[model samples]
Target chain A: MNENRNNLKLGIFITLGTICFVAALYLLGAKQNLFGGTFEIKAIFNNVNGLQKGNNVRYSGINVGTVKEIVILNDTAIEVNMMVQIDVHEFIKVDAIASLGNDGLMGNKLVNISPGGSRSRTIEVGETLLSINELDADEMLRRLEETNKNISLITSSLVGIVDKIDKGEGPIGTLLNDNNMALDLAKTMTNIRELSFQTASLSQNLSKSFNNFQSSENTIGMLMNDTVLAAEIRTVVDELKNFGTNSEKISSDLNTIVSGIKKGEGTVGTLLSDSIANDDIIKSIDNLQKGSEAFNENMQALKQNFLFRRYFKKLEKKK
Target chain B: MIQTKGQFQSAKRFLFLVGDIGQFTLRFFREGFHKPFEWKEILKQCGEVGYRSLSLVGVTAFIMGLVLTIQSRPTLVEFGAESWLPAMVSVSLIREIGPVITALICAGKIGSRIGAELGSMRVTEQIDAMEVSGTNPFKYLVTTRVLATSLMLPLLVIFADTIALYGSFLAVNIKGAVSFQLFFNQVFETLEFSDLIPSILKSFFFGFIIGIIGCYMGYNSKKGTEGVGKSANSAVVVASLMVFILDLIAVQITDLFYEL
Candidate 1:
């Protein structure tokens, strides 16, 4: 009885221990996808950043698979084979990007399978995924050092530019530094101000003159505004134009007469042009004068005769 | 000259003691596995070794886990890695602390008890009487005890590891909040077969050392009450030392196998 009880206790102890061990083992194995339906996929990388077999393969930040194998293909290529759970396998398309990343800061390295573009086809078994190699720590630190050097160079150049500006060494510098130029500028500004004042007063006086000249009392104003006088003056000017035309015609006729006389074309032209005719005209004029004097003497003799004396006395008394 | 001679005699005796233990171990393998196997006594020893030690181991494991968590929390909090507390503590306990602590406790409690019991029996001529009666005392006592420890210690370590993690969960909730499911999930997430298998495997060696050292010290004890006391004292000390040495070796082998 005692032995049986001891054996029973021992059995219970062993059974409980086995239960714990098996439960823990099952959980860990399940995490590794030991019992799950899974498919394999491949990726080639230049570097894996120390990712190893059994590292998690996460899809879009969720762990969907685990790395099954890591093989060094050549000097530059590493082939990573992953066994992903079947349920999530559909989400990983042919163009999925496989890269390496960390679980947390200072955590284990893992394979990150980011989903591909929207239109990519479903992934096939054992198909190689496109990969972007993670920048290792040494490379990142090297780039940071280069950037620091460049920043120092940029800062030094900026300091030089600032110093040059402080010393007034360029076009803006000259404008700042030359005292005589400032004085000339001030004088020019003063002259412009005085000229503007004078211009304003001159414009005012010109406007006043224009106003005065616009009234009809002024001659220029009458010439501008008297419509009737202007029309009369226009008529006189027209008559004067006619007189000029008539004088031109008369002068033409006189010119013709003078030319005819010079040519000795008529009797008056012959009397003027022929010297013998002119002398005969002078002799006839002298005989006609002598006859007129004899007539007058005869008439006086008849009035003194007695036969007509009474008739002459009666005509004189009637007068 | 006299002191040198005495020092040389002591060294020679120590060498002879080692030789005796080795010879004894050889004899145990040769004689212990043959017919008339003491399965009943082995089962009894397993009860004594496994069930009797369970509470002590469980309580010690709990305190160790709780204390470790509380101590580690401030440092992890400094790094803002308090979320890593479960993984970090579980790995520490499983990989190093659980096996070593449980073995040490057993070495003190079980190793000394076996040593003193066997030593008193040997000193009182009980072992000699068993031999006269045609019973193999070494097989009946030493082999069964050793086998019991070898088998039971791994189970004890498994129990201790589970209890320790429970204690750590409670400790984590002392100042902060974490669900039991989440705590366990985190614990199991970082634990791999590599971490789990080697720890439990090393525990078998720890059990073997505790059993054999205690049995060896007691079986070869000098006569009298003083000898019994000496054997018991040396068993605990030597078993504890061997447990540490074995732990060091286990860690080195694990590292090599895992390529850590």
Candidate 2:
């Protein structure tokens, strides 16, 4: 019984030890993806930061694989080999880009593989994954310095503009500070307004005077407004009408005489119809024009022969 | 007169302690490697130390795992890390609780037995007879008992650790929900070779301390049966204290190496 018991106890210890070993193996194997198919891709980076060989490889936030190896290519560049799940092979493409990213702000760093576009060709086994290096610390600091300088300049310019406004030193200042200019403008506006008012009053007065003269209310108003001028005009018109009637009779007699002359039956008509009579009238008119011209010239010659000057001198002495 | 008296008393106690400790250690080393290997005796001791103590260790480990899980829940929840229960429990078991609880149980069970048995033999003149017969009394007595404890305690710790994890599983399902397989997965996933190796290593130290202290106390016992009882009680006390001390040193050493 004791011997059997001893055997049984030994058997138990061995079995427990085996169980522990198997359990540890299973855990390690699962982590290494031993039972699953996987594909490999490699990428080259200028820096790996803190990325390690066993660090996770996340594709679109899902942990699809882990880093297999990391090698320093040069002083400045590193090459990372990753084994991705075979099932996700279709999602990876030749143009797929990889970037080193941290798990969180303070968490471990990992490699992040961006899903390539559908249009891109599927990546083949052992193909090198494209890598994009993040901005180096020095470059980032340089850009930050440039940005800060620009901000400082813009702020200083803004301060200068604000100072100018505060000092009231430009067109805006004049508008704000010059009260006399405002007063002058106000005075000019008042003068124009008064002149317009006076002009309006004067027009009103003129209209009143015209109305007084047109209305038959007083003597002058009556003379201007009543029809007395019309009566005088009518009397003149009656006299003109009588004159026109007498003229008409005289014109008829003249027409008869002219016709008799044409027929050579009256004295005036004979004179008009006779050629000798016409020539005598023309000769007389010519003689009269010549006599007038000669008299005017003799007067002028007599005045200029000192007689006009002597008379003017005698008249001046007497005055 | 007073100073002389105190000095004399101290000297006597010191001599007695030395004689007992020396004899126990010497016999332990001797019989441990002697011919005839004491396989039967070892088996009987193994049953006594390991199998008989199973229920007590199991019950304690189960409650320990359950209580630890329950207590840890609110704290982990505060950090929003409730899912870390399995990993956290496994680490605690492998590093701290597994070795500690196992050692405590052994101190209570095995340490007292070794001390009392040896002390009894010393008082009863069994040790004197074996010495007279040239059988090497300390060798037969101290060696086998110490060897049994040293070997058995580690095994017990291993069994205790396994049971503790199971207890943690049951505890996990009490107020929370985690499948057994999944719990074990999470536990093993976070547990590395470092955790396993260090914990297993520390349990051996615990066993050694228990064995040495128990055999040392019992072999040096005096004052007949009363001395035997006193030694047994003191052995349990000292061994338990040693367990904590050794655990502390183990942790420090583990940390020093592990941090690198």
Candidate 3:
């Protein structure tokens, strides 16, 4: 009976111990993705940032796998093999990106697998995923140093500009500081206002003259506005135009006649242009003069007789 | 001159003790596998060593875990890492505190018990009677107790670790809120096979050391009640000291492998 009790106690103790151990192993193995249907995929990176085997592989922030192994391919590339649960296979595609990240502020390194575009196929077993190198501490520090230098330059420039402005050295500073310039600018503005007032008055006067020209009572306005006078004037102008037309016709006929004479084509033209006829005319006049002279002699002889002398005396008394 | 002579005598005695232990270890290996196995006695001793020590180890482990959590809370809270309570406590218990403390406790309880029992047996000539009767006293007493301790200490450590983690979960709830499932998940999340298996392997060595030292002291005890008391006391002291030394060696070895 004692042996039986001893056996029972030992059995229970050993059983409990075994249960504890198995439970621990199950939990730990589950965490490590040890007891699951898993698939392997590769990621090649320029730098892993201290990532090691057994580190977690997360899919869009969910822990789905562990880093199975790491191989240094060359100086600049490293190959990391990861074992992920088969369940998340569809969520990870062929074009998925893998990058290194920390678990927390100061935690272990892990591989982050981000999903790709929906059009891409799911990643195949043992396929290598694309890697994007993260901004590591060194790179961040370098960029920060550059930014600091730029900020320093900008601040220096700002200080120079501010100093110049404080010293009243530039145009803006002079505008702010010079009271005499301000007074001149104010006077210029006032003069411009006075000139605009005078221009407005001149415009008003011109407008009044235009109104007077538009009135129907004045002669100039009547010329512009009286319809009856305008029509009469138009009739007179029409008659003058007709007269001018008639004069033009008469002058045209005269021009034709003159041109006919100048061309020596008619009797008057022959009389004017014939040099032989002119000589004959001159000879006839000479003959006539001679006959008149002879007749005058005969008359003188009759006057010497009594009857012709009495008739000549009576014609002179009548004159 | 007398002082020099005394120091030299002490050195000689220490060397002699080391030689005796070495011889004793060799003799155990040689005679241990001989026929007439002590299976029934080993089972009985397993009950006495493992099952009987479970309650005490469990209670000690619980207090240890609770105290550790409470003490570590302020520092972790200062860093805003209060969420790491479970993982931190679990790793601490399983890695170093759980196995080593369990070994020390066993060295105190089981080691002294084995030493006193065997010492009394030797003092009363019970072992001699067994030898006269052609029953091997070393095989029956020393081998069975050693075997039982070696087998039981690891089981005890596993129990202690589990109970301690439970205690830590309770303590975590004292000042904060954490579900049992979440706390245990956090604990197991940080615990890997590497953290677990090496510690467990070291506990086996711890057990072996405890068993061997106790048995050595007790089996070779001088003939008297005083000698029996001395054997029990020396067993506890030597076992405890050996536990710490073994733990140091275990940590170094674990570190070396972890480096790789």
Badly placed stretches (over 4 Å) of model 2 are A6-10, A25-319, B1-31
lDDT tens per residue, model 1, B1-260: 99999999999998997888888879878977897899888888999999999999999999999999999999999999999999999999999999999999999999999999999999999999999999989999999999889999999999999999999999999989999999998998898888999999999999998999999999878869999999999999999999999999999999999865
Once fitted onto the true fold, the runs of candidate 1 whose alpha carbons sit more than 4 angstroms away are: A117-119, A153-319, B1-11
Per-residue CA lDDT of candidate 1, range A132-203, in tens? 987899899999999999999999998987777678777666656678877887899999999999999999
Model 1 alpha-carbon miss at residue A298, Å: 58
User: Whose lDDT is greatest here?
Assistant: 1
Arranged by TM-score with the best first, the candidates are 1, 3, 2
> Whole-model lDDT, candidate 3?
0.91
User: What lDDT tens digits, residue by residue, belong to model 2 across residues A1-319?
Assistant: 7678776876576467457656655665666566689989999999887787667798988878889999999998899999989989999988889999976554557899998889999999889999999975567899999999999999999888777766777776665667886687689889999999999999999899888878747866776766887688689999999999999999999998778878977777767778898799889989988998998898778667775878756767999
**Candidate 3 stretches greater than 4 Å from native:** A138-319
Q: Which clashing pairs does model 1 show? A: none
Q: Is 1 or 2 the stronger prediction by DockQ? A: 1
Score every model by TM-score. Answer: 0.73, 0.58, 0.72
